[model samples]
Target chain A: MKTSDFIERLAEALDAESSELEGETILDTLEGWDSLGHLATIAMVDELFGKTVSAMSLRRCRTVAELMDLACGEVTP
Target chain B: MGRVLEAQGASVTAVAGYVPQGRLCNEELSSRYPEWSAEDILRKTGIRTRAIAAPDECASDLAFEAAKKLINREDIDPEDVDLLIFCTQSPDYFLPTTSCILQERLGLSTQSMAFDLPLGCSGWVYGLSVARALLEAGEATTALLLTGDTYTRYVLPEDRNVAAIFGEAGAATLITKRSDLPGHGAIGPFVFGTDGTGAEALIVRGGASRHPQKRRRLEMDGPRIFEFCLRRIPGLVHALLEKAELDLDDVDLWVFHQANRFMLDRLRKKTGIREERFAWRLEEEGNTVSSTIPLTLESAVVSGQLKPGMRVGVVGFGVGYSWGAGLIEWTHGGMQ
Candidate 1:
């Protein structure tokens, strides 16, 4: 999946209707980006890609960029 | 003219259940994580403990197992069955109905009327009403209605708001075309009501027309859900009783949706129904969503608490902010 597509999906998953999320936008910055949203993100990733990310793997990432990198297999955390 | 079949005469053939391997109770989860609490879980949603589904298990998996068990009975001809219904808010997938998966697994006749009922907690009664209608219409001979939901899949463990109240489970009941002796009567005019204005009160933010799964995760308004339950259930109960032409005392048992201890107690007082008239399994099974009512029925029968010829008032109210109730009279030793 494309990084842009993942970002868009993340935005939709967080219920962020219309926000220009730049590269610098924090994952938790969006409204309703709570624990449920977080788990949904992980679930989406797992469902799309054949991999599992523990709660710790998500907790270690600080921003959306890190998550994208992790999703792409470029970073461990 | 076709005779109306009464619920009291019908038999519950079998009941089977499934839960996620990972188990977490309110106190255990609370003590493990300082941020969560028994009271916090209660205030958010009046649930003491809830079950989470295993990573590999899906809604259909649980449903299929329950149906399989119910079908295992020698009296049920698996090949001759004509209907399969799944009732739950948590489905295996958004598009293909979970019943399809269960239908395939159960090796049911391809011609069976297969579908899923996307309902909140009040689904069991809702499914029962649908099954009764189908049976009365003579459209199907044997119908399998399963209520299986994994609400924990929608919420996070840290969400004491929901973590404390929900339990994952599946229960199935086999309704057949049998008209002899006590097996036939009136299911009575069913009573159902909804408040879409309070829709936000008990909703999983993701996975539906309004919120859509692609949009977000489940988010619920705890106090609003509690208030909705407290304010509306008693009125609905009285109205349904009026429709059935029966007094509260005439009802043998009151099986309210097992939302929580607090909510059940509050509703008991408001409805002016004595606590003894109510049947419950909240403490042992937690809240098993739509499965609560049927599972409680099975439990009551096994424990010798309920016997044949007894009438019970069954009601459910939750998520979707929906409410429904039906009066059923038990037919003991009826299931072969």
Candidate 2:
């Protein structure tokens, strides 16, 4: 998946507007970044990328860019 | 280790289900968890209201009520029941087995065999398979398959994930021997799989011999468990259909274990089963663990969605990270 596409999906999963999410967007500041959003992000990654994202690692991500890197890193090779 | 008997056919003759009087509505939960509105709860979990077992109630109590309903509906004499299989994760006590207590409470004969199968959500199908096997082997002519659980008893009110989904319910199914002829209501050709690696994904970590702590409570890794189900169930269903030599169209109703609305919908979509063919009645009952399938079956029957002679596919998965699926021909007299 392209970086822009992944951002769009992540924003959708979090119920946030895609245009509002940038690489440097702080995840903790997002309004909808809760347990349900975490699950939705997991589902989106698994469904779209065919990869399982560890919830622990997802939690460690401070920025949307970090999450994108984590997800993209799994799908790259 | 064992010898096989002359195989006979087995059929589920009746099914009855019961829930406690207490109701936990989304409104109440929404009030408790401000982050989630009632609409959000319903949209996410597909449960608007769920039954909660009373503080004084135990798993056996729910089982007894369900059993009574079945016995009364079928006019079954408890003594006539040769085997009693009670499936539950939340037994009244760790010893003596809840089935033994049920035999006495339900007034079944002392000569009748009784035991407990400690399983969670996948339990009803597991219990049904066991009962059918015994009947098919001619070891018993009639069996009472009881499945019940009070998962809410273990849930911490503050735990939003489990509290939003798990509900308490009990079900009773009567399996009887039938002639070895191809006919409706005949039960068999089941597929079962277990992955113990996912055990901790949905578990109570602090109880039992391994973790004997008083503060034991249910903990779940929602994402991992969701991924596990997504990874496993579609293939399981297809494999069962292949083993049975039946296609998706051959089955009339698909009754899956009610884990949650979101999971069930995803599974239905993944398996390519049409929405109308899928049986989903969790809006009012939530996910009642083992009792969900049977309860859904009962609901389907009541609503006239299921009819006699229809082939129903039942799949149950969860909380052992275990799963089982099978086909059964519906023949309960009420449906007729």
Index of the highest-DockQ prediction? 2
True-vs-predicted CA distance for residue B278, candidate 1, Å: 0.8
Measured with C-alpha atoms, the lDDT of residue B52 in candidate 2 is 91
TM-scores, all candidates, are 0.73, 0.92
Give stretches of model 1 more than 4 Å off: A1-77, B1-14, B32-49, B182-186, B207-215, B334-336
Deviation of model 2 at B20, angstroms: 0.8
Q: Rate the local accuracy (lDDT) of all candidates.
A: 0.70, 0.87
At residue B191, give the lDDT of candidate 1: 91
Q: Score the docking of each candidate (DockQ).
A: 0.02, 0.44
What value of lDDT does candidate 1 attain over all alpha carbons? Answer: 0.70
Give the per-residue Cα lDDT of candidate 1 at B111.
78
**For residues B1-336, could you state the per-residue lDDT of candidate 1 as single tens digits?**
753434332334445555556666667867866655566545434555566677788777777777776667535667787888899788878778888877888888887888899897889888888887877666776778898887777776555556666788888887665466454333545699888987776666665687554644466654456556655777788888898788999887888888777557656866889877888887645788898888777777776676767787889888887889988766643333
Evaluated at residue B54, the lDDT of candidate 2 is 92
Worst 10 residues of 1 chain B by lDDT: B3-12
